[model samples]
Target: MIRIALKMLVGDRPKYIGMILGVMFSSFVITQQSSIFTGIMTRTFGFINDSPLPDVWVMDPKVQYIDDIKPLQDTQLLRVRGVDGVEWATPLYKGLLKARLSNGVFQNCNVIGLDDASLVGGPGNMIKGKLEDLRRADGVIVDIVGAQGRLAKILPDGSRQTLDIGDTLELNDRRAIVVGIASISRTFQSQPVIYTTYSRAMNFAPRERKLLSFVLVKAKPGVAISDLARNIQSQTGLKAVTAEEFKHMTVMYFLKYTGIPINFGIGVLLGFLVGTAIVGQIFHNFTLDNLRYFGALKAMGASNGTLLRMIIVQAIVVGLIGYGIGVGAASMFYHVSKKSELAFRMPAELLIVSATAVTVICVIAAIFSIRKVFKLEPAIVFKS
Candidate 1:
């Protein structure tokens, strides 16, 4: 019976191919778009992903996401360090400032002030220079990805045109040098990140600043992070959050407060629904066109159950084929856009979820088409 079904489905290969292609295109769009949106949301905290410090983050009461600007006194670091479970505490300075490019054009940049000595909260990928380049008063590092293209162009004169290891530039209206060219995961908020010393950031930054913004707390190996967060919050009058909690908070801030996720989600849902409906209708019509043959088989003693099974098999075949094409297309798109300044990424977990989602939609559509086959009358063949 299975072999018989395969021959019939294969005989009508042209029509079925059209249906499969439709499904393939739909699945590809939904999977790709959803994965990209989720990836961008995840990258919001790309700054914290490589932190080799403690498990807790202390932020100002008002700070919501990575881009949210708030300040804490320089003294707050000691307060968090004094917490019972804290192994060490470090101050993180994050803000936006303008840098003068070699071409005399000013480029807006996200500034990161790391502890000069330890270099915590700095980039993990240093392409040209070492992280210690920020130790000098005018020392700074710019993102390779950030400095590409227009901002990447060097000045004509050797001194101004070069982004060499020790080249200096101005940051936040302060005379600064380009010490290193580092690379980091392109995040939604900070695409072009500039690393500088804590003192330089404090001085170059706006004078309204009275705080350190946030403190990174490293809990002792055996210490409970939750307990440490609670203790720090109780003592410092600031909010203490675990790494995961902070991630969720930042994600939520973008999703709920900003319209990005809402807009992206709506587009995704619409794509899924449109894809399912279009593919399902095409497959259903294919079944209807073969109804007379189905009726003839029924008269010859083939059961409705047998016909239903055949329909399911065809659906599964189409689904698997479509999924393969769609996922392959999405991967190609991901890699092509990865090197550009554009924000697009696909993690493994998201890929799995997207595949499963498309598969479920395919199965459900196939089931819908099967229901119509079960309704065909054996007498239909006798009439003609």
Candidate 2:
């Protein structure tokens, strides 16, 4: 019965193609938009995601997210380090600074300061030059995305090229050299990033009474990160959270405080509505056009249940094919744009949600067709 239903569906080449295309368009829009939303949300916690060495993050109690930098007093670092179950703790300086490019252009950049001895909180990967080169006077690491944007240079070929190892810029009237290029996750703001020692970062950034932005701490062996974080928060009177907890906190903060979630939700809802409208109308019309054949089968002793099953099988085939094409296209888009500034990540949860949405569309479309067919009179075939 299923095979016969599939053959019947395929026999009408035009309607078959239209049905698939409708579902395909719907799935593409929903999947792509959802993936982009997830990607942006992930970037909200890029600092914690990139730095895996820190088990606990200590920050000001008022700080809601990573970008909400409420600078802590330098003495806070010592306080966090003195907490029991803390293997070690280091100061991390994070601030926004304006850089005077070699071309005399000024651009805002994100500056991060890692510990001098351990280089904790530094970039995870370096594309050029050694990480240790950041130890040199006025030396700093520039992220690849930043280099390609604010630090790009125009070539004779009329193309822009990212800054190289020897590129130099000015920060706070001080000469800053790009000693290395680091490959880090692109931030939501897409700002250029610079990394240097805590002391150098302090010199480059505009002077402030409190320079320490965060305290990155690692828990001792056999110590639970949550327990250590609680201990630090109690002892130092600062807000402390495990790395995973902080990431979740940052994501939740953006979702609740920003309009991003609402916007994405609207997009997905529109996709669902559009898909249902297109597929539902077409499938209903298709069933009506085949009413004479359906009446003939019923008159010949085919049960209504058997006819309904055939319709469902046909809908399932169309849904599967259309969904496969849409998802494959979205995946390919992510793969191709991974290196570009446009962030698109198709997480497993997104794929599952997309599949469920497509399934709902198909079921609804089938239900409409089933209703029309179930009302038909078998004797109507003879009249026709």
Candidate 3:
């Protein structure tokens, strides 16, 4: 019985292929768009994620996100350090500056200042040169993507020669040297990233009355980060939050203020509707063309339950094939764009959501066919 049902489905080659294409197109759009959206949202906390040493972040009450810097007074750092359950705290400086490249091109850059003593909040990974090199005069670390991208020179062969450790640039009229290349997550702004000691960063940045931007703190052993954050906030009168909480805050700020989420949602929803319509119509017609055969089976003592199961099996087979190909293509896109500025991350949760969506589409398509099979009378086979 299963073999006969399988043959019936495969017999209509054009409809089978059309149905598969519909499913594939829908799956690809949903998975790819969602993954890209997730990737961009994740970058909202790139700075926090790069600094693994900080259990909590202390900032001005007005600061909503990393890019929205509200400078804190230098004394705020000492106040945070004195709070109970606080193991240690260090200053972090963040600001934007215009960088004059060696080629005379000016590019906007994000400058990060790490604590002079512990060098906390510095880049976690380095592609070349040592972090300790930042201790040298006029030294800074550049993110690998920025070094290979905006800072590099295009060669005759269309390849790029990236800025090296000894490359120099001017920041706010002060000379800065690239002493190291750091491997860090891409930032949301897609600007070139430069890291240096807190003092050096202050010098490179336009001098301000209060230069301290943030306080990176770690909780004492066995101390609950949430409790410590609350304590620091109360003692210093500054806003304090755990790393995860800060990340969520940043992501939420973007989602609330921007139309990115709505745009992606619309695209996914349209794909779902199109897939359902195409697959549903084709499957229904396919079932209608095979009604005589289904009626003949009924006349030969086959039950409606058996016919229903066969249709479901056919839908499942088509769904799986289409989904696998679609997801595989999406994965390939991520791999190919890894070196570029394109951000695409496929988390496990996204994969599950996409799979569930494909299953729903298939079930809906199968249900449409099931109704027609159930309505057939055994005598119809003898007449037609």
Tens digits of per-residue lDDT, candidate 2, 1-384, equal: 778788889998888999898889888889999999998998888878888999999999999989999999999999888899999999999988998887677889899999998999889899999889999888999998888887787666767888999888899899999899999887776789999999998898787899999999999999989989989988888999988888898999999999999999999899889989999888888888888888888888888999999999989998999899889888888888877777687988898999899999999999988887899899898893
Task: Let me know the TM-score candidate 2 reaches against the reference structure.
Answer: 0.95
Q: Which ten-residue region of model 1 has the weakest summed lDDT? A: 155-164
Tens digit per residue, CA lDDT, model 1, 5-107: 7777777887678767866776678778877787888788777775546489898888898778688888888888888988888888888878777567787
- What Cα-based lDDT does every candidate model obtain? 0.78, 0.89, 0.89
Q: What are the TM-scores, per candidate, against the unseen true structure? A: 0.93, 0.95, 0.95
Clashing pairs in 1: 54-218, 72-211, 72-212, 72-213, 155-161, 167-178, 168-177, 168-178, 169-176, 169-177
Measure candidate 3: CA RMSD.
Answer: 1.9
TM-score of 1: 0.93
User: Can you write out model 3's per-residue Cα lDDT over 280-321, one digit (the tens) per residue?
Assistant: 889889899888888988899899999998898889878988
